[model samples]
Target: MQNPAAATSASEFAELPATASHGPLRIEYRWVNETACDAPIAVFLHEGLGSISMWRDWPQALCERLGMRGLVYSRPGYGLSTPRPHDVKWPVDFMTAQARDILPALLDALDIDLPERRSMWLIGHSDGGSITLLYAALHPDALAGAVAIAPHVFVEDISVESIAQTKQLYETTDLRAKLGRYHADVDSAFYGWNDIWLNPAFRDWTITSELAPIRVPLLAVQGHDDNYGTMAQIDTIADCVPHAELVKLDGCGHSPHRDAPQALNEAIAAFVSKQK
Candidate 1:
């Protein structure tokens, strides 16, 4: 409740036409400061199991701080986007695939052009943070800057342990019902992320080596109290991308945006300002 927004953004669905990689997804999204014609755009990437609504007013609050246009959306298998079929299990490189394929497709579907992309910034959290880094590495010139909060570049024991616990909570607690308020197909969203994370093959997954090519201004953040990961996540990012700036919030958790929104906003705003 500390982070507040005066603007009331609204959501709309963008219908992505079929692409060779994957498509025809109906993505629910919201725009902030859409009428700010000359301002740079900030496209938000939600965390794994996150959606447009799950973001709450934080995106709006941040965009207002930076005086930038913003776009927030639900990924294909989550939120109000086309839900994943029950039989389909996500591949190990699903996050990368989203950065490489789905994001660009969504931007195209929304008529965001190369010029706009060059001025855009990606603000992602958790799994969305991973996607932001992947996108930066894969398409360096496509965006002006990026902020990755609590991104995982490699699979860690703590990550697996926490995820396993989350799976148990999902099954035994009211977590499903809680998340259902944000996702259209709660089971599809929950299982799609949970099953793949718990899969044995996912233990060897790592994207730490793939970040050498990212040239955009990047800010990597993590909370000291995060149950889902450790400071090593952002430290490893600094190791891979030497130019990256890091922010470690002491009293925060897995979701820095929720735990320390003001600090997160200040870090991002300062990072982007330096880029300018």
Candidate 2:
């Protein structure tokens, strides 16, 4: 296996000479260099504990296959981006901060203002899927379409139980040590997300009501054997968005890109191509 740190390099990006904001919390982003194409720019959102580096070669492969520009970046506390602040756990309004605040701010900071000139196509996984739904709902007109893998729309008993199990693994296993390889500060990313989700107040978390407002064409997908969430998660998305398409992959697991790459790629490519 390759060293995770050795995998960190700007050349991996379609656009080099990385552009970033070194503000209170440094955020790095890149815009593909080629002239804009017909397909919406594919913005890959990582999973709950994932960062851009953790995505490995998946985004690059997807962009090439779909013939679209790719935008992949670390959230506030993941990858090589700035660490989360020292004083706080994830706020109750964390999703809002990601959708209403961080995303738009990143776009503005990058000067990607005109959605009509070049719209976006969101491909999100896990918690990133939730954030995508929230964004599409709040900014319905901004995207051409969206695809979410193993998305969670509401807190479920299964989800809470799974997360509790993850907490135990974090404490007793090498999970934390492994996570340290991907994040600049493991605690910033881990605790910020873990502590909040496991908090009692978060049991009532639900984005289904907020997601109903999204008018874009949505493709909700899930693995048959996903360890983290249930099929009901993506099912809820399709139910809410009448036009949403649902695809269930057999013999697959939590990480579709990892467990079912061929199927995931074909589905996304088809959805994005048809949107043109």
TM-score of each: 0.96, 0.88
Report, for all candidates in order, the number of backbone clashes.
0, 0
lDDT, candidate 2, 1-276, per-residue tens:
011132124623212222342234467554442333344577888888999878888887887788776778888878777678867778776876688777776666555666531377888999888888888898888887888888888888877788889889988999999999988888888888888888999988888778788888889889999878888998888788989998899999989999999999998888877877
* Model 1 lDDT-worst window of ten: 1-10
lDDT of 2: 0.78
RMSD of 1: 3.7
Worst 10-residue lDDT window, candidate 2: 13-22
Error of 2 at 223 (Å): 0.7
- C-alpha displacement of 223 in model 1, angstroms? 0.3
Give one digit per residue, the lDDT tens place, for model 1 in 1-276. Answer: 011143455667889888776757888887876666577889899888899998888988888889898889999988888999999999999999999999998888778889889999999999999999999999998999999999999999999999999999999999989999999899999999999999999999999999999999999999999998999999999999999999999899999889999988888888888877
**Any idea what lDDT model 1 has?**
0.89
